[model samples]
Target: MEFSRRAFLAGTSALAAPLLLAKCGFVGGGGGSSSDDADTLTFTTWGTDAELAGFRAAIAAFGEANPGQTVELNAVPYEQMFTNIDAQLQAGNPPDLFRVPYYTFGAYAGQGQLLDLGPYLSADTQDRFTPAAWAAVQNEGSPFGLPHHTDTSAVLYNRDLLTSAGITTVPETAEEAWTWEELTGVAQQLRSALPADRYPFAYNWQGNGVTRWLSLLFQADGAFLDTDQRTPLIDSDAGRAAVEFSSSFFSNGFVPANNTTTSASYASEAWFGGTAAMVWSGAFQIPDAETTADFEWGATFAPRNVRGGSDFGGNALVATAQTAKPELAAAFLEFVTERDLMADFCRSASLLPTRADLQGDALTFDVRPELAPVFAGQAATVEPEDAAQVASPFMSGIIPVLQDQLDQAFLGSQDAAAAVTAMAAGIADATR
Candidate 1:
């Protein structure tokens, strides 16, 4: 639990010795004359071409507006981020500023590796975001990060297929909703369009597919782990139902027999080819939908699980100890997070801004009009289900358990109750 400043600083100078001469180009160069002021601050991120372009333009704008300061950026590839970041941080320094996906927020912020900026945001500036998102991103009292943008999971459904099937738009209200059985039944009815080797839904894996399933649990009033966060409750009745819920899709011919997936482009192929009626994904998945669906396509909120919550996410900005200019880092955060900048970044990034009012703004709706349902759904709900935070190391270690153990249930190979119970023990040990 200790910050261990000495352990962090011990080899920094020696490891940094060779890089001192060229550190300006690599680390950003303006650590001011003062000890805490650095000449440069580094940043890192990985993403869409449009989003990256916007980020670079924003950085350039920031540097130009402040002649003495510079922002050196490294857009780390998604596949290589873990490897590169591990080596960089363990070394003398890492990035001054960086993006932390929600999946990793709990781990980093809980560990004290990130600098706190809660006080900085408290000034009349903090009123814009959804409070649930704020709690979701903050750790303890210190705000380790501020959300950059957010998008929740939804069912991207094919309208022509639904209309052809005699169904209208996605159910307007959650209560008029298709319960799990009805959802699968509809998939069975639509399965006629599927050819050999494909079924109804395409699953892109995350948290071994458990997090996605957790939305069901949320609707059912079940939690991923107990309140203490020590054990995963995925083996319980509701947990089993969540598992049973997904299993029904695969078994009932509603979803493809996913044991041997040949391609990750399930979303593109299934929907485009008219092989599947819907797949679950976020707004970032919209651009692909735009290009791929041959018929009218639309997205609707994740069906309400019995308990009534949906999956939610937001990109958070963090300041790492690697920056010598913490003050500048904080200022830049303020600048980018300013409502105007956030709106611009969200537009290009194919995301919703963290600001509540912007959700209804004309410009946002204009860019991704299909997302009106999404905006409305999120605004209607005051709280997103709480997220499960694992330590950084625990993330890598537990993911396989999700895929191998938890997914086995969804794929029909293992009992959901048994598989989920096994993972709970592993989570406890690894977390300790």
Candidate 2:
């Protein structure tokens, strides 16, 4: 993969913004227990203000219930999670009960850094949450992590802008969302009516471009990568189609031409200021968008592919193998994941708590109901089960290669097929 000869003005904030990655782990221990069997614990997690607040609310009861135990929150920048985790592990000190992203689960579990909670989970416990929501930690044959929640995007649109462009109709179902051809027609229409300085749509991260670049990947269809993890699934025809579809915006002119330097703040500001009519981002961004938009705005499921798809990202709670307080940590985990507490947790964070009951009807026509389409699309779309696995900060460093090389396709330098070929080579190179 080749990078455009350029510099990005956006400050590198250690994106923990989310990317697929390898894995890393950490450990944490609280004060020793009065008894040998007692284990003290500490925890860590990542997210924006609303998410953190919601999590705090969920754990409040747990804290009160176990006043005698020590529970600490370790807030680390999402981007540096893996790096910080490694440094701590090397230093012989780490948080005892920390969160792990889906991507890192394999690495952490493979390294024995994260204590497997499989033996601890009973069939009754397993049935408490939706199987789909647990996509993060469910590997080949065993479950390595406990899913707490999930994240997916919706198209945040400017109602006024749509009306101005005479595109007043709103989609009520995924099928109603625009088709790629139809989307391009709108982009052309929007450009003709709007100022040249304005863009029709804006999105964060690089993969959305990839998603647009291709229609789908063969590996995803049936040959899903075997346990070996060295498969050429993404380079298939369907994969290339999906890759090109995502990149078409830059290649086709719906998105800004000079996109490498386009930062998250730029897109958010554009969406709010009306310079951009639509923004693609996870449901959690509602609070951010709400605080900034002037006119009416709302979310809808993203446009469909041959099949509808959306990226999934989320967190998992796990106890470390050497935790001095497993019982206390386990209690904390159980408390936060309880159905009663989970809704409050999801509401505060604007997260779709993984608990089966909390993931469904609990979100409609209430508590920022505009986000319902995002979750609905997630549950219905035929998406890769391992979405969170791609969000690990551990493999973040490698994504840039894939990002830059495919950026060419986005810029129309190469076709989607070539771009993905470059991506496969890049992933192999990075892993080696």
lDDT of 1 by residue, 181-261 (tens): 667667776676555565556544444333455567666666555433334555567767776776676677776564222
Residue-wise C-alpha lDDT for candidate 2, range 126-168, written one tens digit per residue: 5666645554455433455677776665678888887788887
- Provide the lDDT at 324 for model 1: 62
The best candidate in terms of TM-score: 1
How many Å off is the CA of 107 in candidate 2?
Answer: 3.8
lDDT, candidate 2, at 17: 21
Poorest stretch of ten by lDDT in candidate 2:
4-13
